[model samples]
Target chain A: ELKVEQNPLFLSMQEGKNYTIYCNYSTTSDRLYWYRQDPGKSLESLFVLLSNGAVKQEGRLMASLDTKARLSTLHITAAVHDLSATYFCAVNTGGSNYKLTFGKGTLLTVNP
Target chain B: DAGITQSPRHKVTETGTPVTLRCHQTENHRYMYWYRQDPGHGLRLIHYSYGVKDTDKGEVSDGYSVSRSKTEDFLLTLESATSSQTSVYFCAISESSGAPHEQYFGPGTRLTVT
Candidate 1:
């Protein structure tokens, strides 16, 4: 079974501060995804990291994948109130099934 | 915004009643999936369909059943609603089982069992 673990499940940070959410997975897989969900809303895709050393950045959010270590990270460069949302990292178990195992998610609250 | 929509945006039902949630997609994706999200469990797949009439179980498929009669519709049925079955159900669609393709999620249906 593929397992995904995320750190600091609940994070409280001040606006303009920087933080990073870590996602570690068990088993070997190359496809990783980052998603963000606001309260009572659907998830929005943030980044898709396809290989080792692949990094994607949008606005203040940056996501990187290290397939050898079975780890992925979502880095927040400068937090803002609008960035307060729950972020999730998912791993695709490569095969014909293409099932995804997702981390529990990191709930971030940015305070001004 | 992948042209996927889940019906019954919010539903409140009594225990022991059967509830069916509908997921319709316009993207013509080859794979459709049903997932439930709870407080601490994140998102756990309930079922998935690879093609019309081709369905399979997921990690949490005990109380749920799914059917795909057409390429655009996937239905998730809760045989008997229970308090434990109450959660936000999300339907996702993917173009293929291949790598580097991301799944697109629907608006979600919030089901509450009383």
Candidate 2:
């Protein structure tokens, strides 16, 4: 079984602050993906980190992956209330067209 | 938007009843998937289709069955609804088959069994 662990399962921060959520997997993976979900809402794609030292940014959200460490981080810059949501990271192992294994998720709440 | 849609955004059913969830896509993508989301467990794949009439089981396929008759539509059926089957089901699609592709998801369906 592939295990994915995420840090700080729940986080609360004020607007204008910065924080990073971490995702670590048990074994090698083909790729990493980040997703955001608001309460009762569907998942919204945030980032797709494909390689070692891979980094991608969209607005205030930035994601980075370090395959050597089997770790990925989602950094939030200048957080806003609208950024409050549950964030999930998924990994697709390269073994024989494997399914996605997801983290437990980190629930972030940005206070205004 | 991937133009993926899941029918019956919210549903309530009784135990022992049968229910079917629909996932329709307009992107003409070759890959489609069904997943169930729950607290602490994240998203667990129920089934997936690579092409028309080609469906495969996922990790949580025990209580679920799936059929894909058309390229754009995938159906997931619960043979006998149970309380443990209550979850939020999501439909997703991907445009590529090589390696891992980013999956685009629909709004999701919330099923409650009482």
Candidate 3:
């Protein structure tokens, strides 16, 4: 069974501060994904890290993947109120079926 | 929004009642998945379909059933609704099983069992 673990499940940060959320998986997988969900809303795809050392950045959020370490990270640079949302990291076990195992997710609250 | 939609956005039902949720996609994706999200469990897949009429169970498949009669529709059925089964169900569609293609989620169906 594949297990994904994320650190700091609940995060509270002040505006203009920086923080990083970590995601670690148990199995060997090359594809990793990051998603964001606001309260009572659907999930939005943020990034797809296809291989080791792959990194993607959008606005104030950045995500990176290290397949060898079975780890992925979502880094927040200079947080803002708009960045307050629950972030999730998922791993796709390579195969024809393509199922994703997701982490518990980190709920971020940015104080202005 | 890959043209995905879930029916019965919010439903409140009594325990032991049979409930079915519908998921429709216009993107013509080959794969569809059903997942439930809870407070601490994140998103756990209940079932998935690789093609029309081809379905498989996921990590949390007990007490839940799914069927895909056509290419665009997937249905999730709860044989007997229970209070513990009350959750936010999400439907996702994917074009392929490779890189450069990611699953797109629907608006989700919030089911409450009383």
Candidate 4:
């Protein structure tokens, strides 16, 4: 069984601050993904990292992946109240179909 | 937002009752999946289907069953509902084409077993 772990399970940050969440997997993976979920809302895809050293950013959120280290990071820059939500990172190994093993999400709360 | 819909958005039922949730998609994607989310545990896949009449179990698939009689519809049935089975169920579809071809999720069905 593949295990995925995310650090800092709960985050409480003030606006205008930056923070980073880490995701580490146990074995080799074909790809990595980041998703955001708001209270009482469905998931929204944030990033899909295909290779090592792959980095992608959208607005205030940035995500990167390192295949060699089997780690991924989601960095929040200048977080706002709207950025407050649960963030999840999942892994797909060997790329068979789209089977993903997800880590427990990091619940982030940004206060104004 | 790929035209995925899950029926019975919310339900409250007693234990030992049978319930079936429906997922309908209009994108004609080849893969459809079911997942459950709970506190302290992120979305865990319950089952998935690659094609019509083709289905497989995921990491936590006990007490759950699925069927795909058509490409646009997938059904998840709980023969005997249990308290532990109460969770928000989600349906996702992934197309074969496109680069960022991640799973497009439905609004989800919230089931509560008392």
TM-score of chain A of each: 0.96, 0.95, 0.97, 0.97
The best candidate by lDDT is: 3
Any residue pairs clashing in model 2, and if so which?
Answer: none
Candidate 1 runs further than 4 Å off? B97-99
* Greater-lDDT candidate between 1 and 2: 1
- A15-111 in candidate 2: lDDT tens per residue? 9999999999999987899999999999988888878999999999999999999999999999999999999999985344446778999999999
Question: Tens digits of per-residue lDDT for model 4 on B1-114?
Answer: 589999999999999999999999999998899999998899999999989999999998999999999999999999999999999999999886655658888999999999
lDDT values for all models: 0.92, 0.91, 0.94, 0.92
**Residue by residue across B1-114, what tens digits does model 1's lDDT show?**
699999989999999999999999999999999999999999999999989999998999999999999999999999999999989999999986465678899999999999
DockQ each candidate and list the results. 0.80, 0.65, 0.82, 0.73
lDDT accuracy of residue A51 in candidate 4: 85
What is the two-chain DockQ of model 2?
Answer: 0.65
Write the residue-wise lDDT of candidate 3 on A1-112 in tens digits: 7899999899999999999999999998768899999999999999999889999999999999988899899999999999999999998863678789999999999999
Model 4 clashing residue pairs (backbone): none
Where does candidate 3 clash, by residue pair? Answer: none
lDDT tens readout by residue for model 3, B1-114: 589999999999999999999999999899999999999999999999999999999999999999999989999999999999999999999995456668899999999999
Cα-based lDDT at residue B20, candidate 1 = 97
